[model samples]
Target: MSWRRALKDTARSGIAVEKKRLEPLIAVRGAAGLAIVIALSLWLFGPAAAASSAFGAFQAAIATFQRSWRPRPELAIASGTSLAVSTFLGYLTISKEPLFLALLVVWTFAAGMSWAAGPTIGLIASSNVAIMLVTVTLPTSVAQAAGHAAMMIVGGLVQAALIVLFPVRRWGAHRDALADALAAEADYARRLRHDPVASFDPQPLMEARNAAAVTPRQARRRPAELHGARGIAERIRPVLASLADPAMGVPAEGPARDRVRELLASAAALLDAAAHAIRHGEPVKVPPAALATFRTPDTGSILAGAPYRAMTRLNTLLQDVVETAGGAPQDGAPSGARGTARSAETDDRSTSGRAPTHPGARGTARPAPTTRSRPTFLALIPKALKAMRSELRRGSPVTRHATRVSAVAATGYILGTWLPLGHGYWAPLTSVMVMRPDFSQTYSRAVARLAGTVIGVAVATGAVQAASPGTLLSGALAVASAALMYLLMRTGQFATQACIAAYVVFLLGMGGEEWTQTVPERVLLTLMGGFLAMLAYAVYPAWETPRLRTRLADWLAAQGTYAAAVFGSYADPSASNAPDVRQALLTARTARAAWHAAVARATAEPVRHRGLSRTAADDAEDALAQLGRVAMLLEAHLPERGATPVPPAARFADALRESTHQGAKAIRERRVPTWDAVREALDAWETENPENADKVVRNTATLVLDTLTELSEALDTAVPPMTLDGTAPEKPDGPRNPKDSATR
Candidate 1:
């Protein structure tokens, strides 16, 4: 081979190798960002310079442990006991023989508990053990070391007690908040059917749905509440099912159950109708008959008897708003209100020779859509289930991304400990906690770490100055400083507060070393740690944006297909196959969740892939919003019930299928094709009338095209062309991913 060719090959090979090397290092760097700051603080101040640093670490560990402990009391007792045992064991191992073996045992125990019970317990127990061992070897006198250990035990006990007693009252409050939020969501959904002005943003609605669905499960621990709600839903579910059935109509035996079910069905229908109206930007008309049903005393009685009274009230309010919007004014106008004046004018006109006339009243007044002739309860259940499933699936991407992050953190922690960097033990710990793939978190951690180190230095300097050089007073101050550091660590705003307290105690304990002598060294070490963390995070960063975009495209396609099926059924009553309709609805909901996940991933990692930044993500999200609007519009145009209508199912399916396919193709290519071409293609597909087999193929093709277009736009903006190779590249002299294929 020619030397020129060989050189080219060599350069190409080298680049590939470098890329591979950088991948893992990037992950490590991202993870290590905070650890570097902590390490720098320790190195600059020296272990002895910040005796309180140890105490701060201990407190931070305990706080983490407490958070992980499910159901407060068990966590407190477990964390406290573990802390005491680990500290005592660490002290014994350091002061006596078999130091290495003893350390191993403590390490193993901490690791096991951390993995099994949760991070909070493991961190506290491990830090205590590590600190106890380190203090034994420090230049401090045995008596001084003993005093420091005693304070840690006391602080741990106090923290544990506090955690157990109060147990962060927010959990229950959050549950209630979630419930209220869900209630609001249901009301909003109901309003959308009738009120054209009501905002049709699905995000808040989706959030509330997810919250309600999940909260109920979480609150299930409160068996009484859970059972009560479940019982009501269960009882109402069967009755509603019976009423929704075409053959059975309404059940005659259970009057109350039948009535409640009818109301719920009516409410659901109203919500569906509102959603349709909002999507189409058209006014919703509430029939006079529907208003009459609500005006009855029985309506209030039925609503009051329901498990979710708030939901019922919200439904009623939404109906009233819709009625008003439709130009049909209801009773009980506010005193001296304009509506009352209008009513008086109408009455006066009726009494005189002329007839009452209003510009708003154009269309003929019709009775509200009746529940009497609606489909049976069983029919609606499948549709509801489908919607619920779709909503749940939307968060899958976030869950996956979080899982990956946590796994990386756990691995980094284990590796850092195994490496056993002397006097640099905190480096790995800091990195794991601080480095996040998400830029916002990464930036926050880095800032906090830097601030903490600076404060720690200042505090250490002051303590050293006040205590005097090499005095007993210095040692006492060190113990007091440790306690103070412990307190600061609990606040959890920034790393600097705890660092300040820790560094001050360390200096005092170290016999009041001159502040001028050690400040620079501490700062330098901190910088080094930060650099290392950055390297680890950047080298082989795992970008989740691309995957998220792809998932969303698939979801959108599914929703489009479902919309087509619903529309198709509307066109042909003979195609009264409810199962297909139900499945389509479910598919649409799942698509909604996928879209949400994609948005969330983009939001979290705003700078993941070059063009796939926050801006791109937002654009993709906007497109999804449009798609949802389209789906709702199609549903609204469909006939309520009758013979086959215009826009057959086959045509709708073809358009949606092409749209989805196009979206997926776009993502894979990382290029957003002009959606106009795809949209035209769908329109053409719908225009062509074909046989059943041909129609299915055409429909599938349409969905594929649409998906491809959406996917392309989303991915093109999120994932950079260079990073599309699905591999992390290495950089010179950088920590890299061990798992890189090129390395192998």
Candidate 2:
């Protein structure tokens, strides 16, 4: 990537139009609310007050449109209250330039730091600061400022009331999220039928989990179908993978393979049916053949050992999915008692049921899976504060963004005020709206803002000049422009900016500004603000390209920890000192997410990937994904607590932990790493009596070795790879058992 290429890519992205489904009903509702507020304000307080108060309804409506799980009314009220406070506070300092400038700096900095919480919070906060800069200028006296503030609250209230009265698809987002997760699982099952090793992206499941967290107020009113289905979906994914995977003891080309495929196809069909039912809030119509496939006793005879157990688990789980998604009440009765038919044989066998074992093997209780309680809205404040405080370090991207944006904002305001432009606030306002934490968004938004302002300002000014509409008609046009903006909000930044620009023009016209006098000032000031924001980013960019290697290393380390934890459970099934598998898995997920986000951001950056090429990055991601998948498979079969311990696994787990810790450091230092310790551990385990070893432990260990070898090979392609002592790294040995190799 070069400067020229980066600029070209971002420019294209800036102008790209997305095809999105229009929410006509929601758009009309928002527009109607804005119209009602405008009408009342014009009748009682005239144009200036109307102009100031209109922002409350407009912004509150925008807040409701954000992809958040919080209730719409809550978002509206929060947005309105925050805007009113900002406007009221800004009015008190408008009398003195120094005081107002100081207030502006502190406020903008806090808004920048809000990004640590999340994008939704950050955007809403930033919008408030920009709105404050404009709204504060509308009031002349303290009493007038108070009145404007009160009207802003009223505007938010009006929008909230309408939403409550005319609700459209309550819990729609939650239903959609859950449905998407189920749909993704369905797709994964279909893909696995052709290629059992196909990768599955867990992003949809992660989003569903986020949506599942609701405030107590919401939980009381939530639909029954939304409950328990997500957990069942999570359980189904691993079972499907284990059943399809040949390494789990199913033959690649035999009757067993056909059974696996048949089971996969049935699972896919059932999952699709469940997804459709949940998404559309309809009755679940399980395909008779799909249910019959699960009920067939022939499946148990075709697949033996691990595959057989997986089949049994799948049958029971599918019944749960059908019942839960179909909104059937969950009583203590068997799933067969519910609407969906269940296999009598599968129903009698518990997943953790006692089975005939080897002479020395022992059974143990499974550890209870941990669940996190979702925090309430009020409870999240302290968590947000903690997150913000953590990002105060110099190296944090959020901190850098805060510093860069604050500086740009202050400079833009000074230049805007010192220049001859009458409406100087427009300059800094544009800068505030355009800037973001990353290069792509900031540059793209800058371009979008300038173009949209030109087009928007032109159309509105031309219409005003031609129609010569008075205050009443101007208010109507403003409302119409806002409605258009809402309708096109998700289409692209270009259309959004255009509507916004036109809306502003009409709003100011209602306040008695001549189009000829205000038009040139707005266009020029917008260009000035956009350029300032772009220049600030170019000078102080927080490039993710340079950090790609670090992100990869972090992910690798997290994977190693996860693998070690699963192995530790096998080593000492009853040992309280074993690492928490749940916590380890969570850490790995977070690291993987961070790595993906970095890659996405880096792809948009102008700088060349310093250590990793595009192909190398993709390969590395694939290897790591495989590594995580194998670990997840092992986790699915982990020995229960107090089970007979495989002592050799303890040494292997220690070796894995130590070797990967060293490997991560070697990665950061730009040197290829060797897995000599892991190889030696495998060799030692093989040297011990081969026939007496636990088969499950033996097989999964070899899979771990294979994945690690692939990971090492992937990283070997890094640009300018280095080695220690002028020698290449040692590769981990393959499966110790020849039979294990055949199964793999």
Candidate 3:
């Protein structure tokens, strides 16, 4: 079969295999969801009935909300409102005024429902106050009020857990898609560097140059324009000269040409994949075979070569162009304008019978070019306005998620209020704020809540014991609570502040009870509430482990492809292209991000994903960092107009690419390459190119093969083999950093 046909068939087969592998994971997730529902139902009716019922109801509400809401301003308001209403209901139950309590309950419930349906914090707060007034009239004892509060706490906890376990699918999906795009981009960059001639048609280069020349001055101000300009210049440099003359048909004469071409193609494909992933939100797949094709050469000799020196000169030229344009006078300037005036005089003299000024004429008085001014605040206003207008015109996906989160919070609030789950009424309120799918935020909130509860309980116990229950004492406590709440709120630690404030209110509302006698009970109740909140936060967990792992794999794959392209480009220097350079940079950036995230997540949840936990994430991060440095070198050496003293970055890129591919291949095949053999190949290449003077262009096929193979092998060994069900093994017990394990 033709190589092209074989390649196409392999790609198709690989995709199919990957899809099949993923099916079981989807099934496992579904089953987990069902199991949670059943467990929660059973817990609600089991021996710890009071706590269970309240917690269960809250959990159910949160679950429903997660299924519906998208995080946004509207949802934030809705969730806040739901919390206020629940707080009011707890107050009503404690007061024991049946008629007033019933009315307030109805009001709070209705308000919560309304807020959930359409988010508004003001409405929710107003409803909460109305319920609180009714609570003041109830004839209940302090003990009874505390019991109801306990139930509320339990309910909120359950809800929080469920939300954690089952995160919204859309967010995860989008993240995965972004990873795919990055991988494809890296591949593209590598290919272009390896085989510039075949990878980029001359027409596009010409068109790009024309566009650059004709681009509106204002358009150049865009950030992307700068990147595009640089990329185009680098990619087309080699081809530019050839296109001008057409006599530079320097074909590869050896076996290396075919290999080089293949490497270039692979790099291009990877970059294309990355672009697709970023644009469309797809998954990234790195092929194992690509890694087995190349070997890296030593870069020291290449760096000392004449071609490398020439490339450096080109970079200086490009810089000069930028400076020249920046220094130029604006169009339509007055004849006497500072910089232009001198140029105008020169032109006038040249047009007349006088001697024209030499291009290098200096020491003569010439008007300094008008300095480009920095943008002012007023100048930025139009851009800001444009952005705002764009946002207003476009629909946002986040809004939907926000709404769902609010609805869940509201549901939890109402259920906790109505169920009367003993002295932990505030637990549901805690859950509303703490139960986020993003584990990082949730964990932070939970810790804050626990700390605040401890402090609040201590204060309440001391104050209650010291003061006799009466109007004056209660009023004083209330004032103190409000003051503390206000102060803490400014710190932006909402959950902690709320917990402290609530405790003060609980103490004041106890109606003259002796604090010394009730200290133990109060502490226990507070602890219970905190415990419930934590549980709810963890129950419905969305495992970040798989996502992190997958991202690492994709990044490694991209690096391998990039390396191969770099090698090929060095072997035959005429193949540089703009798209390839851009892809390399983009892929490197993505890989860096992925590595960081994985490391963080693993540290946060070390015990959950087998022994591969945070350590594995760290290792991957180190590897990516090394790869990133190499990519930067490749970027630096890309051909550009008028460049001289080019760095040996292209040769380095080629060698690195080969090494990486071989490492990856070894990992995938479960056969480690002899370190000496790999080293020897690299040494030989480096020796031949010491100053890498050849100027012969490398292509994709030659660069990628060995590096890809090595990379595949390394990654396979580092990460566990995909199970039949396509899931990693459960994490083993070990000391782990909570921060690293948590995912946001």
True-structure RMSD, every candidate: 18.8, 5.0, 22.1
lDDT of 1 at 345: 15
| lDDT by residue (tens digit), candidate 2, 1-744 | 788888888878887789998888888999999999898998999999999999998998998898988888887888888899999999999889989998999889889999999888899889999989889999989999999998888888988998899987889899999999999999999998899878888888788878877777787788878876776676677788888887778877889988888899998998899999999999998888987787787776788888887887677667778787883533332433232222111211122222213322311122332222467667877988898999999888998898887888888888889999788888889998999999989988888999889999999988998999899999999999999999999998999999999998898889888897678998999999999999998899899988888888888888888888878878887654323665676578889999999998899898877878888889888878887888777665656555788888888888888888888888877776568788788778877748855877777777777777776667777755566554555544885333357678
Specify the highest-TM-score model's number: 2
What local distance difference test score does each model get? Answer: 0.41, 0.81, 0.38
In each prediction, how many residue pairs overlap at the backbone (N, C-alpha, C within less than 3 A)?
111, 0, 160
Q: Once model 1 is optimally superposed onto the true structure by TM-score, how far is the C-alpha of residue 376 displaced, in angstroms?
A: 39
Q: Which one wins by lDDT: 2 or 3?
A: 2
TM-score of each: 0.46, 0.91, 0.38
Q: Ten residues in a row with the worst lDDT in model 2?
A: 343-352
Model 3, range 431-497, lDDT digits (tens) per residue?
4444333444445554555555556666665665566445444534543453344333324343334
- In candidate 2, which residue pairs get closer than 3 Å at backbone N, Cα or C atoms, i.e. clash? none
The reply for model 1, stretches above 4 Å from the true place, is 1-70, 73-164, 167-170, 176-422, 460-464, 467-522, 543-617, 629-662, 671-744
TM-score of 2: 0.91
